[model samples]
Target chain A: MAIRYPNGKKYTPPNSEVKKRSIKDYSYSNRGKTLEDEIDEANDFYLQRQIAVIHKKPVPIQIVKVEYPSRSAAVIREAYFRTPSTTDYNGIYEGYHIDFDAKETESKTSFPLKNVHPHQVEHMTVVAKQRGICFLLIRFSSMERYFVVPLEMLQNAWTRMLTGGRKSISLVEFEEQAIEVKPTYSPRIDYLQAVRKMLP
Target chain B: MAIRYPNGKKYTPPNSEVKKRSIKDYSYSNRGKTLEDEIDEANDFYLQRQIAVIHKKPVPIQIVKVEYPSRSAAVIREAYFRTPSTTDYNGIYEGYHIDFDAKETESKTSFPLKNVHPHQVEHMTVVAKQRGICFLLIRFSSMERYFVVPLEMLQNAWTRMLTGGRKSISLVEFEEQAIEVKPTYSPRIDYLQAVRKMLP
Candidate 1:
């Protein structure tokens, strides 16, 4: 049995150790899907049941050249990825405009601030000012746990990094400020429940 | 002098006659900008002023091949456009969810229903069901007129078309049911003014 801390979070190995475990561990199974996939599945579940209208925004690409083999078919010959200007997922839920991004980190102890872009922070700030529900759905992959952290907490973390404070949010801080979203089989990630709890 | 109809609208020339006027009029002027550009600039104006947070969702692209020459660079080699599953724009305005698509038509008499995609109508229906303020920003290019038509109006038109009715919304119908958005020097679309008027 693995040793656990007083709070019952199992000890996570170092980055090098975790990386080594994947050596010859290329399991091409559904279990290997990324955090993005899980959230997408959850969003799909929400959409089908009419629980919410949230959707992941499509990936933006800048096209430079196109080839028209026929009048009906045009293919992109050259293009580049455009950095998204806003959060990945946004839509209305019970008349509330909800906006958020999903982030995953292998580190169990802290979530790095570098995962979020400055412009995204600015967008979320404006959304929060509009009184819309804005936040980050962060997944601690190593611990197999998720948390719905509010935008205010993220803004504070951003300020801390700029003012030469901690560059990341410690697990203890998250446990204090965030609402844990337990993963389930059907919804995969029942984040809306946490959102409901967050609502006044 | 232009002939005015009963509603004070100037008589529009036939398409052939109107298209003939531009035989040598290849003007590379700001006036030649598309409705998409106008809406984008208007969105920028709104964003800079912190009015309402709305944005155009980017064109979705499907990637087939990419070349990463370096750790920091990725060039897309092959890609194809994917039909968007929702409207072109959506965001929050004064704590209300706003969703819409922009369409421009050369015809001055009617806005063709063929301009709207079936999936887009379905998506907007879901958004409206969720209590989002959804509509279409339609521009009659030749007349330099724009109208903000409610989704319900579009839905009714769609139903009528399917039930052996007109395949388009006549200009008279638009004038009666839709709000005409005056194009201005600043905020070229001034759509939110129309949206504000729309709010109860």
Candidate 2:
């Protein structure tokens, strides 16, 4: 099932005819790598140089069955997702506790609210109140751009969704507050420079 | 399949004949809930009052099929587990970086080394090298005892394991190095007190 796009349109599975196209056919595409793998490699690159300590939060899962075919490998045959209660990445960088979730959206004009969960916003509020450095690393795939928007902006947008406003953060508002991050091969999404400028 | 108990014995599923016992029959037992759920709840409790901000590092999973029944629910139909690169819990506790793993054993006299992955010990050492507070919250069920053992002790045991020594930490060693933690309802495992006495 496709999720509702930021523009309130249903997203359908791309046809196999379109899927056969090469990486050049898609915008902001880093070949065929999944989001988690790319971000993980990026974080490893950052950590190797003692630049920062950032890690992806594990997706919660409930396992029901495991078949042991061999002594070395036990294959999980059944599992279900558990609702997450917080944002993804969090750690200390240069003595500042950094918290954020990295997200990529195909929408052109805005990023949808549904892309973010309510608990994640709540998590941001708690982190902000504790004086932790918090933000969301948002990527506009169609535009091939990434931005780090402070927690306050996300809090406001999250509140708006609660009060019957549009379920997305407008591109106009994001441009006003977010610090742009240029994509790189080594770190993939180099966000520390933006964090430095924001927190310094 | 059941893992081996620390006492060099395999766990046979509790007799199927005893399945009808009431909740009080096993009130003191580590049943009715899984270790992961307990850790997750404990982390939530710790985060709410600003006592600590620990979270389980997510295990990487390879997703193969996702079925969307409706607009809201997406069910993961097929996936496989992958190794996690970091420790289970890592966050700032009282201004000091705290990282650890909570492991339970059915043994009465020792905790098995096989329960811990080698990479996890490596991760803990890295955290300790950075001067972060690191420890293991180990629970022995047959004895109904919980202990917080320092990472140094764990590293020593892990090194011994590589040399074909005992693949467990004996009760005598745990009694000396591990701080006893009395389980509670709110935090379940109140480990900060141990932190205060040790790291502080």
The top-ranked prediction according to TM-score is 1
Write candidate 2's Cα lDDT for B1-200 as tens digits.
24732221345466442355567755544454445566677778878787677777655666566556666655555666677777777776655677788788878888988889888887766666656677888877655578888988998998898899998999999988879887766666667777777774
Q: Which residues of candidate 2, in runs, are more than 4 Å off?
A: A1-37, A64-72, A92-96, A160-167, B1-41, B48-50, B57-60, B65-77, B160-167, B184-188
Against the unseen true structure, what C-alpha lDDT does each candidate score? Answer: 0.80, 0.71
TM-score of each: 0.85, 0.75
The deviation in Å at residue A57 for candidate 2 is 2.9
Residue clash pairs of candidate 1: none
lDDT of 1 at B13: 51
TM-score of chain B, candidate 1? 0.84
Tens-digit lDDT track for model 1 on B1-200?
A: 23422221234455443444564443322255667778888889888888888998877777777777777657777777777898989988888899999887889899999989999999988888888999999988877789999988999999999999999999999999999998767876789988886764
